[model samples]
Target: MEPVFRPPSEANSYLLPVTTGCSHNDCTYCAMYLAKRFRVRPEKEVLEDLAMAKATLGDVRRVFLLDGDAFVLSARKLLRILAAVRETFPGLQRVGAYINAANVAAKTDDELRDIADAGLTIGYLGLESGDPETVTRIRKGASVDEMVEAVRRAQAAGIRMSVMSLLGMGGREHSLRHARATAAALNRMQPRFAAFLTVTPVEGTVLHEELDEGRFELITPEESLRELREIVLHLELAGSIFRANHASNYLPLKGRFPGDRERLLETIDAALDGRISLKPEYLRGL
Candidate 1:
């Protein structure tokens, strides 16, 4: 079996592998699913796993579908799995999965609603960078407009979104552009949760090759912090939870948007001024 990955916030959730790998695994910087071909697990197997989980860890409150974009599964199949989940763990409070714009576009409005009503409530979207040039270079597999529309449609169907952006995804050339455009996009989407992760070139990925060949220039840690500040300064979220505390971040930041925006900026400024320490290079990871 392929290894599983989940959002940091889902550390306590029971992970259920409904899919083997990412449906669209061509992102330049990602190497998470390179060893596994994308495939939806058999319904029988999925149900059996849920049953085993229930028997082993009774009354799970939260379940996160894995390995990557489990939302790529058809509504019919997902709904069946959700039904089985509810039956197996009557106390299940929420279900979440990695989602992409293309997966959202493939599902009808009604299908999204039905899925939400059945128990799948939150979605994790990797809005790596909103700069069109960066988006193209990364082969993110979805346009900015497509991403905005997809998030909006999912939100309309009652699915709360937790959107993530990469701090240095555009490398040095497009750093500021990436930050500002990403903030603009987040302002438009108004996701329930927003997170920032620094871009790390991974082995076996195009980004790593680009870095090795000098075709890509990763921002310095200070530059990445500036890029993060630019995004935070421009963000116009309404009561959204903002986080930059991922392991990959040089400086950890977390607070509510609009309310804590100013304080967050001050924290960044302090880090910039050397009043607060940044995480060492050796501690950061993807």
Candidate 2:
């Protein structure tokens, strides 16, 4: 089995690998499942794993499906797994999974609604960047329009969308464009949650090769903070929970949208003015 990963917020949830790798794993900056082939585990094996968890852990309130983009599974299969989860845990509160725009787009309204009704209430989506050029350059496999539509479709089906964007994804050339367009996209989607992670090139990825060849230049810490501030400044979310506290970030930030927008901007301004300390470079990670 391949290594599995989940959102930090799901640290206490029971992890269940419904898929082995991302269905669309061609993103230029990602190295998370480069060595693993994408495949949905058999229903029998999945059920058996749930039974084992039930016998040992007794009951779990939350279950997070892994490894990556588990929402790529057919709605029927996911509904079946969710049913088994409810039966095994009985007290399961919610189920979450990593998803991509294509994954959400693949399912119909009825299918998504059925899956959500069966306990799968949340989805983590990687928007990466909303800049058209950046989106194409990264090989994200979905366009900005497709991304917005996917999130809206899922939300309409009662799934809370937690969208993630990557800071410095456009390198030095298009930093500001990336930030402003991303903010515009987020404003349109108005996701329940919005997160920002800085781009850190991994040795095995195409992005690293680009950096090596001098084709890409990562922005300086101050530039990244400026990009972040630009996005926050332009965002028009209603009440989305905003976060930039991932380990990959230089500065940690968290606040609700609209309500805390001013505070967030002030905090970023302080960091830029050297009044606040940023996370050390040596300590950053993906």
Candidate 3:
């Protein structure tokens, strides 16, 4: 199995593959799992992996389930997997997984709570763009409203959500709208962690084809910064930690909501005005 794709913060965590590929793999901008089919590893295989990890690493603090959208597993199966992991690794502290909104909606609130109680603590969700039009164009597979409700329910069930949004997902045409709408959605979801990454159109993705055909226009670097500023200015999150330091981002930014909001905007302004140097295009990556 391919190494689990995870956030920077999860670098030290053990990657346990619960599912292979993404359940919703039609997102136009995504190329992460295009070459693979989505499928859940059987419970026996999951437990075997956990046992192997336990034998190799005596102590494990964090475990991240992979490859993508492992939360799509049924409540019972997830619970069994969580129980096995906890049993195999007595020192386990947190179990995290990628969660798709549709999969989240499939679970009852009680099921979510049960999974959380069983040691699954956090869920990473990709909300590439919150503008309804952009979401539709990208084939994200769920409406903005559906995603909001899904995250809300998961949070209510004690699962801390780490939400991610891509800055240039809407292209030049809907940049401002995407930023504002995304801020609004984040305010409603109030995720524990919110990340911003610049869009990177991979060669085989629909987004790349659209760009090639002149159907979509990529946002300029300055416009991407402006969109970030618009989002920071409008975000009314309670305590969400914001990050824009992805390698794909032209500028790195990190701050807490409301409290460090002004500072974040200032940084963007400095970058926009040439007061601070932006990351060279050569150093940027997806």
Candidate 4:
């Protein structure tokens, strides 16, 4: 089988796996966790991966761990993985992985620091929304407050953070509140890097079914650009790296935030009203 996680951008230069499947896989919009039971691969297996990966690529400077949520590893187990990777590779500069809010809550501050010190310096959290109602609707598990506390705790523990906020996650019924609340969440946590992903439904998922049945109306690629506009305008992040460079983003913009924010938002607005769609405009079609 192919590796379950791929680099989301050009920044990552190595492959690693901290865990497999997603811990909070019940989100209505996701199909990633559909085919498998959620589980963290054993530490010895992961250590062997480190050895194999090093043999494949020497002088690997950065590693991005695979799959939906790597933080599911117990603090001690994660620490062991990071240490082994460093001991084996010796030239790694950074390590990163996706983390869920519940898993963030699972570890104590000291444990987070221990993992960071062992070499995992950055965390990528998918804060799909800050609206409690929206989170419940999708079963994402972490509340707005829980997300805030989680980022705060992880930072206090020395793990620098990045987050993904899904634009248009609220759909037609809740877009404004979604933007405002998501903005509020960012204002509160101010992660080191934050990104806005325009939501695109994938097949074999409840959200795809809803779109198919006309039960939920997705904002058009045009409307998604509009929603992203609102999300960015109200966003008040402090010196964070921001990107909308995912293939899913209509306009693949990337730059330092609280800096190019106005230009980025304006560009999104223009892309929304653009005569032609900014992207391929696949609506999942169920």
lDDT winner: 2
Residues 1-71 of candidate 4 have per-residue lDDT tens digits of 24265436525557676667777788899877688677778777888887788787777888877767887
Error of 3 at 256 (Å): 0.6
lDDT of each: 0.93, 0.93, 0.91, 0.78
The digit string of per-residue lDDT tens for model 3 on 195-264 reads 9999988899999999999998999889999999999999999888999999999999999987999899
Per-structure clash totals for the candidates? 0, 0, 0, 0
C-alpha RMSD (angstroms) for model 1? 0.8
Q: What is the C-alpha lDDT profile of model 2 across 213-233, one tens digit per residue?
A: 999999999999999999999
Q: Report the lDDT of model 4 for residue 257.
A: 70
lDDT of 1 at 37: 95
| Model 1: per-residue Cα lDDT over 1-286, one tens digit each | 6467899889999999999988899999999999999988888888888888988998999999998899999999999889988888888899999999999999999999999999999999999988988999999999998999999999999999999999899899889899999999999999999999999998899999999999999999999989999999999998799999999999999999899988999999999999999999999888
Model 2: clashing residue pairs? none
Regions of model 1 farther than 4 Å from truth:
none
Worst 10-residue stretch by lDDT in candidate 2? 1-10
Q: How accurate locally is residue 232 in candidate 2, as Cα lDDT from 0 to 100?
A: 95
